[model samples]
Target: MPTFTSNTAQINFQTFGDQSNPAIIFSNSLGTNYSMWQPQIEFFKSNYFIICYDTRGHGKSTAPQGPYNLELLGEDVINLLNHLEISKAIFCGISMGGITGQWLAQHYPDRFNYVIVCNTAAKIGSENTWLDRANLVREQGLLPIASTAAGRWFTDPFIQSNPTIVAKLSNDLGAGSPEGYASCCEALAKADVREDLSKIRIPVLIIAGQQDPVTTVEDGLYMQHNIPGSQLFEINASHISNLEKADDFNRAIQKFIV
Candidate 1:
């Protein structure tokens, strides 16, 4: 396991295939970690250098106290790349990670070759909604809504076939640090990248899960409309569509990047 420490946080990361190959950095959804990309890693490792890391306060990473925003989160990625001496790479992100990808493309265009945003949006939700959810989580841990969230995240068939994955996701969400999670809630609440879309000049691929309630196909459409010449692909899955439809997701990514 490779690791990088900076700015009072430690990010645990894994590298697949070879360093000499072009790097494809992956960022996972909120409450999940690099392990969320497990399905795609093996498939891409032979052709591309893969980098997956636990975002701050997720997975093996330490939970640092933060009122985290997109800029800070984006900086974390930049710092990791700097530490690795990586000049540029492709960015692949899901959900919250997708939001981060948009931010990176907007604020740090020189550092990325392409960005793949899956199941995310320019603005996550209203500030009040996130604040309310954070307060609710603070008052009553995430355990209560774990099943509900999971239900919305995956299709019924996926849940039926992958009970263990569902359980792990529930555990991850339920076990998240309240402070960290709350901070991210604030991040999501305040995030809006529509105006920044024009700043990104790199090729972009927007993949949306058609059934995602949190960030629907409309969200991907909005991104496609906003970013110049951006591409969109919709799959018949829920929020964590990459897991439910990994083959399609992987194929789309391979085609887009090439």
Candidate 2:
């Protein structure tokens, strides 16, 4: 694993493929680290350079105080690119990560050549609802909701076939720092990009899980409708569709990027 330092926090990251190749950056979902993009990394590493980093307060990244919002988190990615001297890259983000990517595309369009957004919406849950969730995770450990969360994240077949993987991921989510999780929940709660979509001029691909309970296909359709010239692809899985339907998801992105 590699790491980088930004103004706010030190980020833990891992890279794959040749540095000279075009960069493909993948942002992980909430409560999970960059490892969530394992499937995509394996598939894309053979061609494009892949960048995976733990969002601040998740994985190995340091957890600061609460009250953080999308803009701050988005800047983390911007600073990471600046640190790497990456002038332009293709950005992909899922769930909470997708919100960050959308913000990045709107604020720093010059830094990204293309964008792939998955299982996310321009406006996430109501702020109060997310704040309540943050309070819940903070008071009680993530363990209490791990099973329910996993169920929403994966399809029934996926849960049945990949018990070990689901269990491990659940544990990982359970182990994340409560403050970090809460901060991100605030970010998600405050995120709304419906007005900003028109500003994105780069090629965009929107992927959705047909069965995703958290961010449904309707959300993908909303993005396609709003972002000019964006394409949409739906798969049969839940929130963590890319993991459950790794092959289909990776292939879709490969074709889109090429």
Candidate 1 global TM-score = 0.96
Q: Judge candidate 2 at residue 234 and give its lDDT.
A: 90
Q: Rate the local accuracy (lDDT) of all candidates.
A: 0.87, 0.87
In the range 1-258, model 2's lDDT, one tens digit per residue, is: 677776567888888999899998888888999888888888899889899999998999888887788888888888888878899999999999998888888898899989888998888768899989989888996777665778878988888999988987898898888888988888888789899798788888888899998888888999899888999999988898889999999889889988
Top TM-score: which candidate number? 2
Which 10 consecutive residues of model 2 have the lowest summed lDDT?
Answer: 141-150
- Model 2 residue 144 CA deviation in Å: 1.7
Per-prediction TM-score: 0.96, 0.97
- In the range 125-238, model 1's lDDT, one tens digit per residue, is 789998897788778877776757788789888889999988888888887766667777878888888887976788999999988888999999999999988999999899
Q: Relative to the unseen true structure, what is the Cα RMSD of model 2?
A: 1.1
